[model samples]
Target: MGNSVLVFAEVKDGRVKKVALEMLSEGKKMAEKLGGDLSAVLMGSGIESLAEQLGQYGADKVYVADNEVLKDYTCDAYAKVMADLIKANEPAIVLYGATILGKDLSPRVAARVETGLASDCTDIGLDDDGKFTATRPMFAGKAYVDLSFTDSKPNMASVRPNALPVSPPDESKKAEVVKVDVNISPDDIRTTVKEVMKTAGEKPDLTEAEVIVSGGRGMKGPENFKLIEDLADVLGATVGASRAAVDAGWRTVDDQVGQTGKVVSPNLYIACGISGAIQHLAGMSTSKYIVAVNKDSEAPIFQKADYGIVDDLLKVVPVLTEEIKKLKAEG
Candidate 1:
């Protein structure tokens, strides 16, 4: 018999990524429902210290493979290490974050392990028999379907960040740590991380933001983003961009949200001048409350929005901001 539930803990700068903890929570729940142990695997250079964080998230065991050659992400190197771990542990199920690194590493590992993989899953649950049933968007987000894997031992699934809420970590519980060595050569490593340029800020990432204010081509120019910014500032929300705005060079790719970009599910999503193409809606249809402001009364966005205002965003956004300010003052 092999391990029960195994989570791939993503490590950045010798620390576990937030989504890694979220997966551990999901794994913990699944393992409990199935009456098994939940394990986590961490791989990176000088990241043995991250095992404790996995324990906090309900991992019963932590397997770590630390080496300088595995310091950065390379498709070949990471896939090799992960495949070996899964082969040795033979976990019943494995979960990974749908982040860039995970998107690259998971498929290769799944192929090596000869298992079925569900990508960017929005929901996962244990059936009566304890099999993993994952749900994800299909047909360009028009609907969703449940996916199941029967012939696989370690059913692989990659889940979107912020799609599932993260449970708080418990520090009192401790997990057993297992150390492993990865054998890698220069020939196996293809890509090298040259430089990492991260945007400086305390602001939450768009995928994790509770409130998001987005702009589109109707905003006219990049300079016009100030209106969107003002509304975001008032609401303490992250700024997002439609593919049209990003293609127009009005915003960076990181700010883009759509089928070709990042998926976001915020508590409140405000779309200003966005036409709500099927692709764009695929990324944000999960938002709890949608508000669309566009001059075109016939825009498709209105159909999906909880609150629709058929007015020029330029005028309506300012008035909305002023009203918010007035309410704050009255309080």
Candidate 2:
């Protein structure tokens, strides 16, 4: 019986990503429920210093595999390190974020460990018999299915970003550090991250935002996206787009929301001018509250939206923004 719950702490620029903190928080809760210990594995070069932060987020133990090869993400390198960790630790469950790196690495690691994997899961928990059960969307978001593994030692899954909330970090507790050196060889890796480019903007990351305002083909053109941005800015929310909009070059891939893009389950998801596609719903149907503004009342998005405003979004959105501002001012 190795550690019961182990979360992979994803790092970028020597800092832990928010999604990793969310995983740690959820992992801690699950560990407590199962009467087990929570351990987090942080892998990256010069990331040992961030282990204490994991402790604040509810990790009982922090395992650091600091290596130069991990300075930049390579699917092969990450998978190898993760496989070795699982082999050595034999945790009852392993969790990864369903981001690009996780999508690339988890399947390989699962194969290496010879275990079944649930990808893009919305929720996970221990069933009545202490079995690991994962819940995921099925049939293109029309239904959800729960899966349980009977014989797997370390049940693994990659959760969609923003599906779970990050608990407040408790700074009082200090977790024990276990530093392990994985003797990685350059000859074992096939890919390399030679250069990295970043978008310079003040806007929030769609996947991690608390509120999101998204547009679709209904916006008609890229020039009209300013309305979407203005509304998002007023609410301090992130701007997103449906695949149709992104494919049309109205937005970048980073701002896309759907099965093929980033998954966002924010507190509020506002879809204006988006004629809902099944793939788009798969990413955001789990949102706490959904609001749709479109001219077509028959649009599929209305079915999932908690509040549906059937009207031309161009006319409705500006009024909606004015009302929101009025309410805020009154408050």
Candidate 3:
């Protein structure tokens, strides 16, 4: 059989993660270039119904491992099953979404399968000889380097979430779903998920949101953060903060954005009063369009921002928000 490009179509809370859908597009492109089929491997209970949705993304086949043990995310159970599947049928390339689950699972699977794995890769492409070449940031996003597996039979790479644009879903496409049965005992599972406690909020998840409004120390204090929140509310963007603001106790740790915090790559990132240190820029530098507003014209954020406004954030934010609201109301 010709080598196939396999992707892990991860699902959470009964919905397919956007990163997985993004991978299908990349996987399809890679498979076409390599002259092979694209297969998506889905592991979880009661997810067989999602196989059809995978086909619209250009998956030639969908492999599912549905069992009660695989219902909740467990490192041991997922890794064991995936390793067994890989050993049984070798794929030329395996692409995983570099999400929380993928970051935790890809390295373990790579070690178990004895293959080269790259993490947080921003880009992956095929070499002239059908080999995989990837690019990933290094030194806390200060620089980037190329990665590849020259000797491994299967090349593995975990791409960052939101790194790729989503393609329109084409329901006209069709694919075959293959079910893989695996035996799992309680002893094989070392850990059990008692409960998952997520932050209660109506706002979208920061990492996955398309737009974000972030603030720094220049916001004066936590009370002034409402200005940032007001703009975010108008734009339907998530709220983020710089490490300076977080360390100063002006914002919660969950809202912090930097190399030490969550890595976000949104479509539009608005920086209000953030001085843009290298560490803070490490997190949101990959955003598509950056708009920075700060009183300091010499702030480093202006270097990377697509648009810059030198003004007092407190004076400028409310006016900008209302202008956007007015445009929306009229449009």
Candidate 4:
């Protein structure tokens, strides 16, 4: 690796994740600015063939550390492999997607390599001096700060999922594939993977969702959330809930959208029965469009809503769902 910008190319099932491709796009731009090559580091079992796809997204080289032990992600084994690779390659910068796996893995890798990491970053760029700079939300998404790693080589940052644009792939581009045997011994891994329990749903991931339909305490009770779910289904959208709704047992914590929960930036956000507290706004204020439905016209949510409907959600959501399905069927 020569003066490289390296991205952690994450894969799910048998395909590379969209966020990883987005990282490659951004990393490619940064690599060009720094006059360096862009590389992707991938770890999995029998995934060497997937390296070819990384080039179209703009990687100059692809490093594949394929092994049976690496098939399932174990914190110790994964971190040790990445840490060792960073020490050897010493790329100018490293990046990962701020997904669940990324959030859990990046910090450990950073600490293992004795480097600082900026997590959930919305923006990353180079300073006038060509130093790496990262910008992330703070104060419950109420504030942001630009940071740089002055003391460390190969500075690291985890880009927030969907925060960056997904660039068109260049099929003409090809990256050199370098296979490395991390050879993580059984003793090296303290944690053993047993069985994975999957969540029972076909819903899209909240962070990666293009459209989201959310509810709050105004949903009244758990059963009322079916209305929110119905609307989400009509729009092919993910379901989200305000912290108040989650705390009230109306929705699961995983569905919570706020400072204490998930941060999402979707193409469209529909808020039903939500009061629009600052904490909740912090999570979804960046969405492209916001539609709020509540009985109280003076609710704080209305202030941030691009479209507001002043009526009881119980009366409105079912009608809206039916209309949406009708329009879809008509088309």
Point to the candidate with the largest TM-score: 3
Q: What lDDT would each prediction earn against the true structure?
A: 0.87, 0.87, 0.90, 0.89
By TM-score: ranked, best first: 3, 4, 2, 1
- Kindly list the per-residue Cα lDDT of model 4 for residues 1-331, writing each as its tens digit: 2467989998777778888998999899889988998999898898999988998889999999899889998889888888888988988899999888899899999999888899989889888887889999888777889898868776999988777887898899888999887867788999988998777688768987879999998988999989988999889999999998899987889999988899998889999989999999999987778999999999998888999999999999999999999999999
- Lowest-scoring 10 consecutive residues by lDDT in candidate 2? 199-208
Worst lDDT 10-window in candidate 3: 200-209
Model 1's lDDT to the true fold? 0.87
**Residue pairs with clashing backbones, model 4:** none
* lDDT score, candidate 2, position 318: 85
Instruction: Please give, for residues 4-101, the per-residue lDDT of candidate 1 as tens digits.
Output: 89999988756687778889988999988877899988888889888887898899999888888778778888888889888887788899988778
Query: Every model's Cα RMSD, please?
Result: 2.7, 2.3, 1.5, 2.1
TM-score per candidate: 0.89, 0.91, 0.96, 0.92
Model 2, 1-331: lDDT tens per residue? 5647999988876778887887888898788878889999898888898999999999999999898888888878888888888898888889988766777888999999999899988888778877888999887677899999868778899887778888998989899999977777888898878899777676657766889999999998999889888899789999999999999998999899999998787889999998888899988888989999999999999999999999988898888888888999999
Better of 3 and 4 by lDDT: 3
lDDT of 2: 0.87
Candidate 3 per-residue lDDT over residues 247-285, each given as its tens digit: 999988998888899888888999999999999999988
Model 4: how far is 192 from its true place, Å? 1.1
Which segments of candidate 3 are over 4 A away from where they belong?
none
